[model samples]
Target: MNADLIIAGAGPAGLFSAVQAAENNENKKIIILEKNSSAGKKLLISGSGQCNLTHAGDISQFFDHYGENYNFLMGPLYTFDNHQLMKFFKDRGIKFRKARGGKIFPESNKASDILNVLLKEAKARGIKIIYNTPVENVKYKTGRFKIKTADKIYKSKYFLLAAGGKSFPRTGSTGDGFQIASSLGHNIIEPQPALAPVIIKNYQFKMLSGISLKNKEVSLWRKENLIKSWSGDLLLTHQGLSGPGIINYSRYMQKGDIIKVMLLNYSKEELENNLLKKIEREGKLNLLNLLIKFPIAQRLIEKILEIAEIDGSQNAAHLTRQERKEIIEIFSNLEFKIKSLANFNQSMVTKGGIDLSEINPQNMESRIISNFFAAGEVLDIDGDTGGYNLQAAFSTAFLAGSELKERL
Candidate 1:
């Protein structure tokens, strides 16, 4: 083998993997091949550039954020969990701060600082990283894997495939690794757009194009059937809708499915109770005026009233019980016809990657191809925003680096 280790991609996972290998193994020759001119381009924009490096909490909590199959990360978490990762950064002079929701951002609040630290550490440990060199193919035969770049070919005793997914294409995650993994004996889970925003039905969303709802609950209904619900800040976009709430439900969205939205997020009976209280508290207010309690624009309130058949000019005190009941219904369950999803520009992260079943979770190594490990968004694992994905990248890379070094 020309090199002991050759890691693909230079995002969070690949950079960290190369760093760890170089840091702990002084005797081995480690090389990282990055397609970008510099390392960690996509990483530089994570956490809105503050770079949520890792989470600061129990391993179970970390596992909880990953999804239903938390066990897929048990080995990785134990090997390089948040505590260990934080310590790793601290030792390298990269200070970090704990943000809301267990997220830990760099104290400098510049993702570049995090990337700089990792790159510097790798360079200091005698690791050679070549940039602007895209890997054309990876061919495995005779118990060895061969990697070919544009200008050169290299063979490594061990390989870590950390190329990212197709989200945020400019970040260098183009989903090329998925095809390469499939060419080997791995099965892909049919990658789809995940963590993207939803386009609400034109009827209800057209009026409130720029309004925002904060701390309000949001529910996703598919054809009158409530599929999922999430609550956070909601942003009215130029096209339709976005926000933490809708983005959370995007994981379950399928093609040809229409997702409905409920702005009030109040239960059927709770709707009735809140409506009556509004009438009792402000009897002289008009129906359009009463809707100010919800976080929409007054003009939007008027439009909603028009939809509900409530007289915008009529006094709340004169509202009939039936009118109030209908108003409550509209507020409680505002149907949004889900048209489609926002593209890569609107998404925070990509959902699907390499099928998890094809890789050994313990070391992120491909089961069919010896010494070929996979990590980060390139694998069939993705998490929500607020630093979850960064943590996954770091954890899986840590495991792959350390575990692969053991056999050497």
Candidate 2:
């Protein structure tokens, strides 16, 4: 064979797997085909260039962050959890610090620091990384695999497809892995934008672009049925809604879905009672001044009043019963109909990938195709923001590498 193993795409998964395989057997010939000019293009831009590598909490807490396929990932994550992943870099002389929400990043606060360390490890292992060579096709017959690139086809005893999903296509993750897996008779879940911003059908919060709320309740609804509810920090964007609260739940969201955001962290009854008491006691106070007493930002409160068709400058005493009820409803339950997600270009990851059932969690190998393995966003696993996705990539890649080592 031209090489013992050929891994497609040099993102975190491919690079990490190559290092793991090489560390196990130094003489094994491993090649990584990276479509980009440099390795880890997406890795360098992750966490806005800081590269949140993993979360700080226990591994058990990670399961719920990954939506549906959480069970399928329990094996890999447990085998190579966050602590081990940290030690891998820490031993390599990279210092790490934990940020808010348990996100772990390099002490240098640079994503290049993370990418450089991975590249350094891969280089030290004698693994060959061919840049600017995209895998055009893959074919397996008679115990050997052929990987077709633009220039020529290369053969290998084992093949790993870690080309990533269709998020951030500019980073060379243009759903090539999904297409290749499909060609191999593997089923692929329809890829959708995950951790993406939501555009409202008639967004009126453009003026509150930078406004944010903390620990606010966010609910997802289809028609009149409540689908899911969670809480996180939210940011009002020029387009619509964003931040961890909305984007993290974007995987479960679709066009025309209604999202209810609690602008004030109080129930409708509580808000009505509180507002009525305030109006009765302070009849001369301006409506805006009364609302400002709540936890919400003044600008957001003004906009909410505007949306409710109530004048912020008007006195609380002047509000009719209907107007008071309308203002209270807006404050308690602000609703937005989702027009669309921000698309793959703006998404942090892809929601769906190769069907998890087709791959063994113990080995990360394709059950349908012998000697073929898959990992990272190429599989049907996408986690919440704040280092979960990267952690999943590392865990799954390590598992694949472990199995490859024994096979070699």
Candidate 3:
């Protein structure tokens, strides 16, 4: 074999795998191949340029963010929890600070600093990485694997595919990993856009374009049924909607479903009573004033009032029972018809990849192909925002790297 191991993709997973492999086996030769000119291009934009390094919490908490795949992550995450990852980065001279919601970012809050730290670690270990050389495909023969680029072919005894998902093509995560894994007898789950902004068809939302609601609960409903609800800070984008609440809740929203917006972040009963109390206290207040208390803009308030058939300038005192009910309906569950989800190309994290069942969670190696391994977003596991995805990458990479040691 040309090398002991070849890792595809140069993001956090691949880079950390190279570094870990070198540290675990001194005689092991590792090489990382990245399609981009420089490594960690995606890393440069992670956490909005802050490079949220890892989360600080229990392993169960980390896995819970992945929802259904929580159990599948136990082996990898327990092998290397978030605290161990933080210590590793600190050892590499990368300072991190805990931000809101246990999100740990580099103290400098620059993605470059985090990238530089990984680059330095990989370099110090004598790990070979080729830049701008995209892997065209991989062909397995007999037992070893063949890695083919545009102009060269490399053979390796062990391989770790970390090519990531289709999101962020410019950063080199163009679903190349999925193709490679599929060809290697691994099941490939169709990728979907998670943590992406939603498409709202209601033009009334256009009036709230600049308004951002803090601590608001956003829910998804299919046929007047409650599916998912997320409460956090939300922002109204010019196109439709975004922010923590909307983005998190969007994962459960399916095609052709209408999303309901609750600006108060209160429960069903709480919101109902709150609306009734407001009407009783300020009977003469304009509709705009009542909505402004809930964080929506005045123009959007007027639009909802229009949709409710209540005069925008009508005094709360003079409002009839019918008019108040209509207004209450609009406020309690503002329906923003969901046209569709934003495309995968613009999503923060790709929702699917290699199927988890085919790989051994304890080692992150292909169940069908012994010498083959998988890690990072290339795996079926994904997570919500606030440093879960990166932790998954690290945890899986650690398993792959550590398992390689025992195998040898």
lDDT of 3 by residue, 1-408 (tens): 388898998998998877777885667688898899988887789898888877777777776588577789988888898889888878878788888788989888998987787888888888889998888888788888899998889898888898888777777778889988888888888888888888878556665676776776567778778777766777777777788777765667777787776755566567667777887898679756765686566777777776666776767667676776666667667777777778877788888789999999988888988689888998887787888889889989988877776764
**For residue 151, what is the lDDT in candidate 1?**
85
Assess candidate 3 and give its lDDT: 0.80
Writing each residue's lDDT as its tens digit, candidate 2 over 214-331 gives: 9998889998999999999999899998999988889899899999888777789998898889999987998889879888888888777777778989898898999988887787
Please rank every candidate by TM-score, starting with the best.
2, 3, 1
> After best superposition, candidate 2 residue 1: deviation in angstroms?
7.1
Better of 1 and 3 by TM-score: 3
Model 1 C-alpha lDDT versus the unseen true structure: 0.77
Quote model 2's TM-score.
Answer: 0.98
- In order, what is each prediction's RMSD in angstroms? 2.3, 1.1, 2.2
